[model samples]
Target: MVTDTAFTWSDAKRECRNMGGVLGVPSSDEENKFIGQLADGVVWIDCNDLEEEGRWKCREVNVEVAYRNWMSGEPNDVDDEDYQQCFTFMYDDSSCPESWHYWGNSCYKITETALTWSDAINECENLGGVLAAPSSDQENEFIAQLVPDDWTWIDCNDLEVEGIWKCRDDNVEVAYRNWFYGEPNNAIEEDCAALAVATWGNK
Candidate 1:
């Protein structure tokens, strides 16, 4: 079966379980081909807890039959941050494994040039749109192309407080952030929104 809504890995697993079938974890070339034909965009699979490095558990256990298709340098597992990991079948340069620390499955739309956060939002709104929320690898790649070497503002900022940032369009929590470790301290004087320089190691 297929679904149209976006769901977190855990939630997708639960929904699949309740439906009396496992989440579609395609195991063979043929299965993956079928899955591709079955749906587009990111889809949940039955692979998590990738290496037992932690309590990596998924809804199903199919150890002998692993179905993997990661782009180059994938599953980097940098920083050893968390035991929980989910997989998206598409490749996105904006979501390079090294930078996973600061982003999530959000989409973006590029304009002809960079603009302030407010201006960017206004441009999107004027076109009957909101800030982009990329959910697929294809969308991520497209957004990456729009990014110049210089920084650009995405429609994101802290809403609840001065520094608790989120995408302006839907308040989606920023899963990944490239800000300097101690930056965005929410200094009362500089509580606006901006993006990181593509060449910089940190914001």
Candidate 2:
């Protein structure tokens, strides 16, 4: 029941958490309807599926899926080799978009009350949890809801070094994740990981 504006995806999420709400994830028909009526335009939801595929789950438990609005050719396994699959919504087009399709549209949840990505990551590491990777479908759905008209960053990255993908704290099992086509190219200078800002077709 909160309406937030004029803030980045990370900022908005922080605000929600401050009010005892970790972003809004509308699952049931009632929840969706209520969320739609409560807010306008693009807002943050608690959906993310960054860790494992086909395991979508909401940030808040017991939420039901009342709507499934994914962009065309969505949830594709193009980057399964890199395990970089994540979900988010684009206001420009009402389709289910993946990380490679539109990198910038991605959203993330903060485990701490920090403001920048660097700060967030540092806090997560301090707690033995490097941010959080979406391990369920509900997480993906929740992320899709929060995506505003801009690109955001998730906890996934290659902080171990550069151009080497690894989850928080250098977990070896994380190597078995997915990525988009021709992704993780690193491009020499492109060491850090970031969600693309342009749409799929444009990029």
Candidate 3:
């Protein structure tokens, strides 16, 4: 059954226990979809990876999830604080915390205070995220909307090795780039990447 009241994952689990039921752990795609539809937004499931970094299990059922439907780029372990260890689902997949914007199954927020590129990354990590890493034109545009009139730092950088751009989140080579002509010229040996009005450059 769906409940309208919002609660943290653990609190929701405890609430269910108080009612003589356990938190839901969908065992199939159809069941998962049904629960998502019923809840409408941000329902906590029994899945989590606290015992192991990449191994997920449903604590209520005490078994590995038989079916998984993580949104793309999910389970990224947002940061060290919360670790994003628990799972959440939304019917239309657009729910986010207050002050954050949702897009493509991820949440984003522009920092209120100006920061340098490296400092921005640290701040995001502190808040359970890396700097934004737009992998497509549409995603890029979405992030652009966050700071329309100002430049913003992103996850792209060549810090591992000069001239080799990579996404800091996973150390993977960045597959998409929007460098302006002659930009990323390593002017002053800058190794960080930033986005401006529809263009990318080194910082």
Candidate 3's C-alpha runs over 4 A off are 1-94, 169-173
Model 3 local distance difference test score? 0.72
Q: Relative to the true structure, how large is the alpha-carbon lDDT of every model?
A: 0.52, 0.46, 0.72
Segments in model 1 whose C-alpha atoms lie over 4 Å from true places:
1-108, 133-145, 168-174, 186-188, 197-203
lDDT of 3 by residue, 66-101 (tens): 667777788676663222322335544446678887
Candidate 1 residues 69-163, lDDT tens each? 65466556677633223233443435434322122333334566657656777887885557654333433333444574555555556655765
CA RMSD of all predictions: 15.9, 18.3, 15.0
TM-score of decoy 2: 0.32
Report the lDDT tens digits of candidate 2 across residue range 1-203. 55645665567667877877666665544345335434555556655455567554455544644455444775465655222112323233233223212122333343324245566667656654455443334343344444544433445666567666654323434333334467766665553333332211111
Task: Quote the lDDT for 13 in model 3.
Answer: 81
Assess the local accuracy of residue 153 in candidate 3 as a C-alpha lDDT between 0 and 100: 91
Ranked by lDDT from best down, the candidates are: 3, 1, 2
Please report how far candidate 2 places residue 154 from its true position, in Å: 1.9
Lowest-scoring 10 consecutive residues by lDDT in candidate 2? 194-203
Candidate 1 versus the native: TM-score?
0.38
